[model samples]
Target: MNQQPVEGFSKLSKQRKIDWLIKEYLSDDRSYEQILQQYWNGDAILQKLHEEFSENTISNFYMPYGIAPNFLIDGKLLALPMAVEESSVVAAASKAAKFWIDKGGFKTTIINTKKLGHTHFIINVEPHKLQHFFNFKLKKRLFEATEEITKNMRNRGGGILNIRLIDKTADLENYFQLKASFDTVDSMGANFINSCLEQFGKTLTEEVAKDETFTPEEKDSLQIVMNILSNFTPDCIVRAEVSCKIEDLKDDSGISNEEFATKFKRAVTIAEIEPFRATTHNKGIMNGVDAVVIATGNDFRATEACAHAYAAKDGKYTSLTHCTIDGGVFRFWIDLPISVGVVGGLTNLHPLVKFSLALLGKPSAQELMSILAVSGLAQNFAAIRSLVTTGIQKGHMKMHLLNILNQLGATEEEKNHFVTYFKDKTVTHHEVISQFNSLRAQ
Candidate 1:
C-alpha cells in the first residue's frame, strides 16, 4: 500500500481526485474528444503510410509506448514522458537514477553536433587498374573540386570540414560497395554532400576530357561515374555523468543491500562483453531515450542504430554506459551518438507530438540529450531495484491495474475499489466482472 498525501488527495473533490489519477497514471491531459482524435487520426495516417510504403513494412517497427515520470530536463519540469517498452528496462533505469538523485542530481555535458555527409561514387573501370586510379593526384583533385560546395553552408553558419575515402569490399561472398564520409556543420549533411557530389561529378567529366595523356580509347576506359552521400559525419560527441550513494537504495526491504550491490555490479559487467546480453543491457538505456526521441519528433531508428553500433564499435560488444562505485557514491557515465533534431518530420505534423513537445517547454537538442541520459540512468535504477528486491512483476502488475480499470469502464468509486483489490493481490478480470455485475444488480 502507498500513503496518499493528506492535503493532496483529501482536499480534492471526487471528480478532481479521478482527474488527478487519470493525469498521473495515464500521463494524458487530452479530453475524451482529444483522445479520440489521437487514436482515430493516428490510425488513419498509419494506414495510409502503411499502404504507400507496403514494402517498407512500418508495422515491423511496433513497440509499446509508455511514459516516465518525475523527470527534470535541464532545469525544466516535464510530465507525461513517452518511452518504448522493453522488459525490465524502465524499472531498472528509473530506479538506478532515483538512487543517484537521492544523493545529488545527475550532471551531463553535450558537444556541438557536426553533421555527417555520405558521398557515394560509382565508377566502372578495369578491376586490376582500380589501384592506379586511387592516387594522391585524384585525392587532391577531389578535394579542390568540392571546395566551393562549402559556400552555402558557410553562409548559413555551417561549413564543410573534411572528407575520407573508402574502398569496395566483398561482403557475404560477391557484393561490392563504395562509401565516403564528410562533415557538415549545423545543417543535415545529406543535401550538402549530395550537392557537392553533383558538382564534383561534372568536374571529373571535364578533367577526363582535357587529359590528352590518354588516347580516346584509353579515356573511354576511365569512366568518371556516379557520385552521391555517405554516412560519414565530422566530429561531434555528447557526454554525461551521474553519481549516487548506496544509502539512497534503502527501501522497506530488510535484505542485505550490500550483497545485492555486488551481485548487481557483476550482472552489469556481464552486459558489457556478450552481444546477447548487450542487447537487453542497452535496451534499458533506450527506454528513457526513445521517449524523448519520440516526444521531440526526431528519427528514433537512426538514434537506435547509431547507439547500438557505437556500443559494438570497438570490435567488442560492450555497455554503452559505464558504472562504478566510489567511496559512498555510485557513478555512471554514458557517451553515444544521439543525433536528434528539434525541428522537422512527423513531430511537426502530429497534434499529440506538438502537445508533448510543448509540455516539455521546447528543449534544445543538447538539453534534450542530457535529460534523456538522466532518464536512461533513472530507468536503469528502476530495473536493478526490482531485480535486487521483490522482482519486476510486482510493481508492473500494480501499475497495470489502471489498464484493467480502464477496460472495465470502472466509475470513480469502482476505480478506488479496484486499486484496493489490487493491493490485496486478488484482483482479476473475473472478479472485476463479478463486481460490475453485482453493482448492476444494485
Candidate 2:
C-alpha cells in the first residue's frame, strides 16, 4: 500500500502519471474519486454526462486502466479509459497508446449514437388460424405497443424512433417479425422493450377473439411460443479516430517510424475485408473494452456480440478499428457498438466494480466512452508494435517467466535470475535450473 509514485515516472508525461498512479496505487487506494478529482479537475465531466441523461433507464460501467505514461499519440496525451476484465489489456493498450503518444495521441472521432430495441412476448392464437391473422389490427397493435414503449423514453430523452417489420416467411409459415426502434437513454434498453412486447403479445391475442373468421377451436388452438426477448439489437453505433507521428513509432527493432507505420497500416489493411484478420483486429479493441466491462460487471457477452455484429453490420466483414498514417502522423480509429453502463444491476453489487468506480471518482458515460475509445486504439498499437518490432513472444515470455518462477516457489534471487535469463531470450528449463542452482550456491 505505498502511496509513493513509481520511481522515474516523474519524467513521464501527464497521461503516464495517471497510468502509473492507477495501475500501482489504485489497488491500495480506498477511492479513485479523490484521485480523479485531484488530478482531472474533479468529476465535472461525469456530472455533465449524467445531467443530460437519466440513470433510471440506463447504466454506465467505468474501468480505469493504466496507459503507460509518456504517450504521444498524434502529439497528444491520452487518458485511456478501458472497460475489460483480463489482465494485460490495459497494459497492452497503454503500451500501444504510448507508441502513438510520442507522435500525437491517437486521433479519434466518434461516429454516431445508435440504440437497440428488445421485445419479449407471449401469444395465444391457434396454430391453424394463424394464416388468417394478417390484418390491420396487427399493425395497429404494433404501433400501440411502440407508443407505450416510447412514452417514457421520449420524456427522458429517447423514444421509439422507428419500427421495422421483417418477414422470416412469405408464405403459409408461422414465423413473423416485428421490430421497433425505442430510443433507450444512455444504456441498453433490453428490459424496456421486452416489457412493451409482453403487453403487445397479450393484446394481440385478445384482439384475435373478435375475429369472426376464426372458429372457437381455432382461437383455442392458438398459443404464444416464444414471447421472450428479441435478438435484433441492431441499434447502437460507434466510431473513432487516432493518429501518430512518424518519428515516434521507433522501437528497438530498427524499423524507421514511417516504415513501421506503413507495415502496421498494411497489416491493418489486410485485416479489413477478411473475417480471419478482422477477428483479431477487433479482438485488440475488445482487449481494452472488455477490461472495463469486467471492472464494471456489465454483460460482457452482450457488449461483445454487439461489437462483432457492428463490425459486419453492413453485411461485409471488416475491421471495426482503422489505422493509417496521414500527414506524417499515425492515425487509429474504432467504431463499435458498446452498450454498457456505469450504474444499476451489479455495478453496485460487485465489490470490485464499486471499488473501481470509487477509484475512478465516478466518470460520465461519455468520458468513460472516450476512455474506451483510447483503449481500443492503444490495443491496436500493441498488436502492431509487437508485429513491427519485437516479436510478441519476447516480452510476454519474460512476464510469464516471473509467474512460472513464482509458481515454482523460487526465492527472490532465483526469480530475478530467471527473469534476467528469460529477457536474454534463453528460455530453457535447464537454464532456469542452472540459475537456481547458482543462486543456491551463492
Candidate 3:
C-alpha cells in the first residue's frame, strides 16, 4: 500500500526527501537509493544548479546525446546534436543527411520572425466608442508607457512591431484584446515579451481609470484577465528544402528513383489530406525536431505545442512536411513554425546545452530555426522512403538489437557474435532470446 502524501515536500533536504520517498514508496530499498545517488553530479555547484532548475528536486535523468553528422545545411557542413532515448532517430537522421549532401543539401529561407502576445481584458462599453478612444486617445500612451522597457530591445534593432485593439464582443460578452507583435532577435524572447505585455496590462488599467471617455462604470467594469505571451507563432516561419535530380537518389529496394518519387509524393499527400495519418506523420518529424530542441536546452514542450497547433492552424491537423517531383527533380521540404533561442535559459547554464550550441557554431535564433526545420524535413524523408520501400521495421528492429542484448544479460562475446550474426537477419525480441539461449546451451 502507498503511504499518505507528505506536506512541505519541497522544504525537505535532498537526502531527507530521498529517504521519505524510499520509505513510503520504495519499501526502504537501499538499491533504489543508490541508483539516485549514483546519478548525482560530482561537482557540487553544477548539481546545485540542476536542483534549482526545478522545485522538489531529485537526481538527474539522463538521455543519450548522439550526433547526426554530415548535415550540409545552406552549404555549411554541421554535425547536429540530438538528445533522445529512441534507438533509431540519430541513425536515420545521419543517413538522410549523408544522402542529401551529394545533392543540393538543405536550403532554408526565413519567412518572418514576428512573435505576438495579448493582454486579455473584459470591458462593457460601446464598440465604436472603444475603438475611437483607442485610435486617438490611448494608442500613443500605450507606446509611451512601454518606452523604458522596450528601449534596449529597440536599440538592438528589435522591439514592438505593432499593436492593435481587437473587438471580440460577438464571441463573448465584454471580451476584447490588446494584441501586440514583437521582434525578439536572437533570443526566444518569452521573458521580454511577457514583461512588455505586463506593462501593457497595467498601462491599460491605469489609462482607462483616468480617461474621461470611459465614464465611471466603464472604468470599474474593465478587468485585466491576463497578460501572457503566445507560443503559437504562426507568422514566425522557416522553410527548409532538399532538392536533387531524381536519378541521383540511391534506392536498394528494387524500385527506380522515379517510382520512389511518385510513391513518396503520394505518401506526403495522404498526410496533408488525412488527419489520422498526419498525426503519426508529424510525430515522426518531431522525433527529429524535439530531439535537437531538447539537446540545446530549449523547451521541447513549447516547441511541440506550437508545432502541433501550427499543423492544425488551417482547422484540420495535417503534416508539416511536403514532397514534390517535377521535371526530373525531386524536392522535399518542411515549413516549420519553430522558435528557439541560443543565448538564454539553459543555454547560459547547462554544460551540455552550451556544448550543443557551440557544436552548431552558435546559430542565431533564425539560423537555429532553419536548422530545426531542416532536421524535421530530413527525418520525414527518411521515414517516407522507408515506408514506400523496404519497410520501417527492418532498420528499427536492427537498432533494437543492442537493447535486447542488454536485457537478456548477454556477455560481451555473445553480443559481438550476435551483432555480426544479425547483420542480414531479422531481429525480434523473441528471436534474440531464443538465439541467445541456443548459443548459451551450445
C-alpha lDDT of all candidate models, in order = 0.59, 0.60, 0.92
> Whose TM-score is higher: candidate 1's or candidate 2's?
2
Q: State which candidate, 1 or 2, has the greater lDDT.
A: 2
lDDT string for model 1 (244-314, tens) is: 56666465556665665665666677777677987887886787777667666666776777787778778
| Poorly placed runs, candidate 1 (over 4 Å) | 1-80, 83-99, 122-152, 169-190, 193-236, 248-253, 346-361, 405-413, 424-442
Shift of residue 122 alpha carbon in model 2, Å: 11
Candidate 3's residue-wise lDDT over 71-139, tens digit each?
999999999999999989999999999889988799999999999899999999998998998898777
Pick the TM-score winner.
3
Shift of residue 394 alpha carbon in model 1, Å: 1.4
Q: Quick one: best lDDT, which candidate?
A: 3
Better model by lDDT: candidate 2 vs candidate 3: 3
- What TM-score, to 2 decimals, does candidate 2 have? 0.69
lDDT for 12 (candidate 2): 64
Query: Among all windows of ten consecutive residues in candidate 3, which has the lowest summed lDDT?
Result: 249-258
Q: How do these models rank on TM-score, best leading?
A: 3, 2, 1
Query: Which candidate order results from sorting by lDDT in descending order?
Result: 3, 2, 1
Candidate 2 deviant stretches above 4 angstroms: 1-87, 102-104, 107-110, 118-152, 170-172, 211-223, 228-234, 245-252, 312-317, 325-329, 358-361, 426-434, 437-442
